[model samples]
Target: MLAVALRHLLLLCLCVPATPPLLAESAAPPAEPLSERQRDQIDAAASYALATTLFASSDLPAALHAFERAWRWDPGEDQLLDRIVPLAVSLGRADEAIRYALIRAGDGSVSPEMLRRLALFASESEQWDEAKRLYELWLQSTPESSNAFERAMVRIELGRLYRRQGNAAEASACLAKIQKKLLAAPNSKASRQIITGLGGSLSQVYEMFGKCHLEAGELHLAAEAFSQARDELETDAAANYWLALLELERSQPLDAYAHLQQYFAAPGDPLGAAPYELLRKVLVKINDREHWPAELSRLREQHPDSLYGLQAEAETLAAAGKADDAAPLLRRLIDDALSEAAPIDEDSFAACGVWLLRHYAATGEANRVIPLVSQLGKVHPSLDPYANVIKAAISDNAFAAQVNARLRLVADQPQTNPAELLPAAYLALTAGEIDLATSIAERSLADDKNVEGDDLLSFAVGLLLADQGEAGAGLIRRALEQGAVDEESPAAWYYLSAGLRGVDDTEAVNAARRAAELAPASPEFAANVARVLQAAGQTQAAADEFAAVLRRFESDPDPSTRATLRETRLSYSYLLLQDDRVDDAVEQLQQVLDEFPSDPGASNDLSYLWSDRGLHLQRALRLAETAVAAEPDNPAYLDSRGWGLFKLGRFDEARDNLAAAVNATDEADPEILNHLAYSHLALGDRGAALRDWRRALSLIDDAQQGLLRAEIEQRLQDLARQAGVGEAPEKNPH
Candidate 1:
């Protein structure tokens, strides 16, 4: 028996024969058939050995030739075809491999191993139908074979073939069979090898199954399949990741988050970083609901190395208003990212810095934003507008001066951005340098002519020009013609009105009226329009306009606008008092004080009205003192306080406050100086009083000039008569 076995094995090896005598040029004899004994001796071993030797010798083309010869000689020897198929593939001979693979594919003599080799070759050559047909034949023929391992592998390949052919139902049937086979197989090396060899990746199978189910629109089934396959996978990362993705597609974020948490928990899991990122997004979507903090905290604790963890923690802190805590964490992240030897990505760093800066500003801790700004300057110096704006806003005088010097250096460079001129205009305006402001504003406007309708810098320049008098009228006309003006623009109209009022033009008053009509809701516009009406010598119209302004802006939330409305109404009321409408004037002033109790201007004006009427002397004194306390540096408020005290017969106190007001003035304001002169005269200091009244006369405009000149002339004559110097040449009051 041993001798027969050895002879049969030897003949099996020789049955393939040598290279067919190199296809000799001379006529060759026909090939002889193998005897029945020799054919019976042919087994898997001899075929495998011959194929291995030819393949190992690096004679791939000859090896495939030998494998084919061996397969043809013993047609039942499916093992030889198996050896031939891969060898043909290794030699890039797809056509030859397909020929041998088809012959043994459905033969019971063909082993599961041979079917796998054939399927692989067919798949590599993109012979999807042939590969599927071969795998299906092997699967059907070996349904009960002990080669469950090979059977499982063939099923997986079959599944892949069907998947590629877009036959989802057939593909799912093949994969489902393989999954059942794998579940039934014993947990041994062979079974494990089969599991591993099914494309050598369990995740791939699940991914395939997932795709099959998804394309069929069986999402729940897909999720369940993916979930089961993922559980079988030792790594579980990919499985968990796919499962999470499936849940996300279903809009079940909470379930997705749960899967992501598990994925993040596995150490060295391939999907650790990716799952943590998905978890963060999921958490953010439902963060406004309950239990968000727990989810965010879990992510932070579990995946400290993940950037998404740090981002989640930062977002959590910011949402809770704990910006102080978020800043240090963000700084550490930035430092670690930048310290790496690799080049930093500017876009990523800028996005992080922008978030941090916005949070810092929100918390009102502008000083804490310097580090982020400094880092941004290093990485993206060219596009650092927000950084520059923040730096300019947070710094005081000394720091502002230093920043300005540095900005000047940057601006002087030839490659400086023209957009930098906008901030330069703002800095100049804030520094009270009008010429520099004008130059920067003009440059900014020229560079960026698409300036928005309500640009604040343009409005500031127009207002500054208007405050300087008639020299600003041409500038206002140019601004109006530049298409920068809009009907609803309050500042434009204010400037237009002031320019017209300076030249005493009624056309400007009409334009102001149009502006008021456009922005009737704006308190500032109404107040300016009332002032214009008063300037146009329409007192009754002015009073009615002031009343309209107070009513319109009664619900306004802005403190500054509210203060202006109160002050304007009080001034109109005082005008009424001058016109001997005492009852109406007192009612308006009382209403002003009642409406804006914290406004020092309203309080002082009301007090002045009261004292001028001589009805509420004690109450007026208290109100005036309160006004001075609120705005001690305001000379107008101080003068009102002093006048109130003078009316109350506290002449000494009145003199001290009035003198302080007078000395505080850089340019002599006629009304303030006149009040000081009146207080001094009431205190019996005639010389000092005379000196102040004369100074007041020199500072008045044409309207106030007439009144001041008359007062000073009368005071000078009284002083001359008291000193016995005779009336000093009666100077014309007009």
Candidate 2:
């Protein structure tokens, strides 16, 4: 066994084989006196033997020193330098190795091996300039005795290195040489031997060629090269992955799926970084649902805690209306993450907690969010997770105690990162904790003399939405002037549009359009583009964008994609509804509900519209009930149900639900207040109706004032007359 292992280990040496031993001196006839040169050669042979012994013993540093001594003693034994340089480099003495390599090349030595080895070292270490220089020298100094196939391989590697440094013109030059040479001798013995030596590296060369073209945006050429590589090497998983990516880009999902299946079936890749999420999505897009469950189960079994596995399982379960099953899996994942021995970076573990909080928030299961917050609070070093939980609580209508506990969890935590403070401020604003939001925002901006572009943008957006619009805009302008904001960044422009939108500025439209243009692949960005266009009265343009948004999502139907699809449809339909395009809006809304039957927001919106327009009270009641069932604690859904009852003339039950909805949160929503006022009017509590409408009007912003002010003021006057309060109504008690 030792002999067999050593036989294989001999290949690791640069030379093909060791020198043979000489005949025994005692068996030889009497010899003449040695010449000076012969004496030096005999001494060199002794040094070489000692060096070989040291090398066999694995004392590489001593072996290299002895090998250098042998080379010095016998200037004729050039092979000793061959052993010395690579050994030196392997021992982390690269500069010294290169010095000896330069000495050999400058002397126009018989061997180019040292120069070639130096080039390999430089290339492997990513010192592209030195690698390029050394490769050129190696090619120039290569002895005529070197094999043609080995030289061609070096040229191929040099081309690959050039491409890696983004010098595509030079890379193409080298590839063109190889192509030209191949054209001349398509099936030569040299080529056959090179292929035998390369094993799978030939496929890697072609794949890199494809990547060079792909990076240059020459998609057709890239696809051609990748297909050629896949054909040449049937089990080349990298080539298959590239081809799948290119096919998906071309909107050929079935072809992409086929190629991806081939990729995952290949050997030696069960543990490699397969594009599992993209494969899952492509399987979904092409309706290959039958194969997905088994594939995903295999993935989870193999990579249980991987980002792809965890997210894929959780997303699939949630999508199938099995969020209850998904929740415990996410909880266990978080628990396992938190149980890790103090890792150097706990961000990934903390991120797991955020995903659980996100799922609960999205499903309107706010109370489920509290326990994860407790888990994260104990494990996380930063306050970001607590802030995220607060946002979840605000969304899910969680108990005030739960929300307050998370709020306090982050309140005393020291925020060293402005990025951290921004989320906290956003949570405060969303939870109606206005003073805290303002305080954090102001503090963030005041301390923003030096911070990342993301931190500045995040803090600015928080301030803008928290009613410090002018101050926020000022910070944004400074960031723009200082070049901290990239004009082409979709996220930066998106935030810019958010800041400008409150003042109804035309630039907001341009900013939104830019974001849409930069992120044509993002459904959320496209939806934003459509929304701003619709708001700016470019209805036709907005309609086109909304249509584009739908087209973008058809090929990428993850949970977020599905959610955005619903939102895009809703935004477009709301515009149609405003224009009195009732039939068109109804068709789109019906389609949205048909596709996303479990969506609470969709149920509530359509139900509220029916009740508001007096179009279908009975059906609206059913829709409202569905929304309430989906999110029992949601105040908006409760208001919808209460108004549906008011439309059906069930005034007492309407007042009861309206009162419950209004009292659900400390900061009463103006929309719910308006609904409650109408319920009071229907109950003939004229004084109560007048007071509720007045309270709602005071809380209403300019955006809502335009739509509801006239109706609310009219209701107050009629209620005043009914109560006989006459011209005054007890100072419009708020």
Q: Enumerate residue pairs that collide in model 2.
A: none
Count of backbone collisions within predicted model 1: 0
TM agreement with the true structure for every prediction: 0.38, 0.36
Residue lDDT tens for model 2, 1-734: 22222343343344432443364344445557655455445556666777899999998766876677566546556666678767776776664476466546555552477677778877776778767877778778876457888777777788788887888767766665554555366478776665666673556656777777666666676786787788777878889888887888778998998888787666444323346767977887888777777888986776555543665677678778897887777677666656762131355556556667666666656455545544664554223555646554565445544554555554545554444454555555557676665555444544445345665676677666667665566667666666666556788777777677656558878888888899978878878888877777788888878878876665453446656877888887877777788778865676566444445777788888888777567667778898899888889999989988887788899889888889887888887888888777666576687688889888888774667777678766665574675543332212
Q: Which ten residues in a row have the lowest lDDT in candidate 2?
A: 1-10
Model 1 per-residue lDDT tens digits across residues 1-734 = 32344476776567674446567466557758765445434532354456568779886654554455454334455566556666655555454555556666555655556666766767776778878887776677665656766666667677777778888887777667665555565376665787577656656666677767666666766776787677667566677777887787788887887777677777643642355457656766666445667766765676556554565577668768887787777777677666752223455556667777666545555444433544554454323445455544545565455545544543455454554554454444444444554554454444336344445325355445537444344445555566554545666666667767847758667867877777877777778888888888887888888887876765453546656766777777877877888787766765554333345766787777777666456667777887889978888778777777777777788878877777777886777777777767666676777888788777778764686677667767777786696434322111
Q: Top model by lDDT, which number?
A: 2
Can you list the residue pairs that collide in candidate 1? none
lDDT of each: 0.63, 0.68
TM-score of 2: 0.36
lDDT of 2: 0.68
Clashes of each: 0, 0
